[model samples]
Target: MTKAITLRADHGSDDLRRLARASRDAAQTRRLLALAAIYDGASRTEAARIGGVGLQIVRDWVARFNAEGPAGLVDRKAPGKSPRLGPEQRVALVQAVEAGPKPESHGVVRWRLVDLVRWMQDRFGVSVSRQTLGRELRRMGLRKLSARPQDQAQDPEPLEAFKKTFPPSWRRSASSCPRKPLELWWQDEARVGQKNGITRRWARRGTRPRAPHDQRTTWAYIFGAICPAKGKAAGLVMPYANTEAMQAHLTEISAAVEPGAHAVLILDQAGWHMSTHLAVPENITFLPLPPRSPELNPVENIWQYMRENWLSNRVFENYDDIVAHCCDAWNKLLAEPTRITSIGFRTWAHGS
Candidate 1:
């Protein structure tokens, strides 16, 4: 029964039609075109037909257009329900996750979404679905990832000290090496064999995908090294992991170095790596990492990448086939030098 709101006098049918054409939002364009019909002296019923809505919606659009112009017609995100977890609750959740579950109390080694949901209900009397909890966890910058391996016997004190002293040692090694330039190389070995494990693959939701899993024992060792800064690598597909193989790998790595550059090869101290019988290369110096710390070397990640992409889920006929596959995988990795740079690069080892 009340009078309809007046639209802004500055915009005519032509102006509104132009604005409608320029608008990216479909709903906003519809509202603009409906208002244009009104400016053209069309009945409210006609404008409602243009908007594909009832007269009430057209009247609401008219009111919005009269108040704030075209922008007011644009869609606004709906204000949903308030957060289920408060600031204090969020802090508590982070602490509980970091501290991990007490096996005696929680009866689980790891925290799962359902387990966390139960925990929230028991501790704070809050009810949340797994999907909602997942969304909240992601919003809090958390993700489910495989945990890195850490030896129980690892001495944290020396490891921390070693990390702190890395820069000084790096500088000393650079100064000691006889070359105009220096190359930092990470070295490690991985055993690729017929007993290869399967990797994850994309599939439809609620369906599981499978890959070939071999149980044969035949294996080949990949003695690999990468100079991340140069995006270059040197490797040898060896039959065994011993002093002889290590010597051969060191020689290969030395040869891969630039003509005038000395390489500081950072590697873990295996028995062969520390063997006095192994001849040291003139162009390369060894920087042995602390014991039980394979994670310190980026070459471990290179091995993981190789296994996931090329070497996994396959059955090799024999030792020869294993060797061939290892070589092929290494060659494929070398072909993509940028992949080496991306996978092997460490900010601390390389730079900012």
Candidate 2:
């Protein structure tokens, strides 16, 4: 009769239990528990059940643990197939995404999925599906996003100047750790209505489920700001996002902050935001973002998050319904302050 495998005494002692308790990796913990069980005279089948893996996997893990110590339980790189694109081809692709297609040379105004696919085929002899290409682009931290309006003739000197004076400046360290608390509140305006956008959700296989969108083509703008240190959010809902509404929002934000503490608002240079008629509060300052750069403002992240989590896939009867739904979302999001802090905190301006 064939016999079952058992782990070594040294590897599966109380030390193994200590390692398991201290392990952050779930896979490693399971492996340690399985080994400890086996060392305690449990059958291979029993150990496999405890580890939530097949018996063969438990044996493989035991062998690896014997060969190297707790480190052996860490996930090893899969010896999979080599990459489709060569080194030079990947560099070319990255450069193309950064610089965009050359208008004069490529005779293309902007790059579409089909355009990128064609370019890759012609330039690197590679064929990639749209979905696969999207995955690769995401892996490279690139997204195919629709850009906001940018004035072509706008000078970038003022935007750079505003950055130098970022107050409560807390710079992140080389290890991506945040420094001192920054009093900067990220600010942005978003319009939500029956026309709110949609995101992917689970639906019956081979069937599509879609909510009413842009039905009334109406919207209510919400001006929101977040202080990461406090994890507190303040918002003003208004009929419009023009100069008057912006001033009102600023007034509300100024009131929300502590007395005599200067608050810096990092915002894009919208006409209403930078308009001469807009009143600048004494206790507040504006840090204008660079032209054509919407990604610089952390508040942009809140808009997408709100849509996805609380506001998407809804049907509103009237404009009042739209306002109610939108405000409810904002209130719910703000109720959990940690979510706000995690999404909108970026401290890179104050550095030596």
Candidate 3:
């Protein structure tokens, strides 16, 4: 014999009705409707039909509601379904990923999701989904990145020694002139052409924007220098990136500064930059970066910014158009000294 189920003393027909209306959870709404129907004197069979569940399920739900109220009727994770990795296990997993897998032992070049899944099970008797492993990796500051390999034989001591002594060494004679603050300019050269290179862009989902590859072959080398200390920039476009062009760029940079004011120029040890006929101006001093260390150059980032923004995915009709577009981009960049300062300033640079 099934006893009649009634609403609790604190709750009325209005309360049950409100619960059914307010609940966003469809499963919770169904349970509430069933309870409401029973309170309205409906039979058990009728309540089951209204709740869209079998009579036995409805009975089970009624028992839960009676034991724990509305909260009891809400869905819950199944028992023993919690994550396999505990806090300590998670920390261990992070450490293992950071160390990276040994190719000799792991028999793999890199850690893929499946590879990690197997590794976890082997190391800790834990089973984690690929998605779960990825989330854990991200939490521990791991990310997918393009790696540029450096030679193991190359020594980094020289680069370290150069950065250590550069700043205070320059400041010794940098502020001698009153007209200009110490203008520390980092210089780099880039080639802009008709085929500017492909980059990502927003488009309709499941569709790709195809660009015509019939771009002109002609290109021009652009030499640019950004002075963080003075919030200034100087650039020149030439047909070649040789000693003569570099000398011209250096002259242009030297001329842009206040008269009688000397400037410090940080540059990479490229052949053209070190050429005998480079003709470095008397007011400009060149500080060559360590070998194979373009990352230490702030001007390198400017090339990336230009390629990613104005030059990418653009097909110029002629060499003249490329020059015009590049000139416009540099003009826009030059007008925004704050942008230049923000992007160009490095901790090793004067005002960083």
Which candidate leads in lDDT?
A: 1
Candidate 3 deviant stretches above 4 angstroms: 1-81, 87-89, 92-115, 118-125, 145-153, 172-180, 203-217
Tens-place lDDT digits, model 1, residues 158-229:
777777778568657868754468889999999988888788878999998888888778888999999998
Q: Write the per-residue lDDT of candidate 2 for residues 192-228, one digit (tens) a residue.
A: 8776678887889999987666667777898988887
Top TM-score model: 1
Q: Rate the local accuracy (lDDT) of all candidates.
A: 0.89, 0.77, 0.80
Candidate 1 lDDT trough over 10 residues, lowest sum: 171-180
Residue 316 in model 3: lDDT: 84
- The residue-by-residue lDDT of candidate 3 on 104-219, one tens digit each, is 99998878989999998998888889998898788778897645455466578876776787777666645545456556788999898876688677889899888655456789
Q: State TM-scores per candidate.
A: 0.78, 0.58, 0.67
lDDT of 1: 0.89
- Superposed model 2: Cα runs more than 4 Å off: 1-85, 97-120, 124-182, 202-209, 268-282, 286-293, 350-352
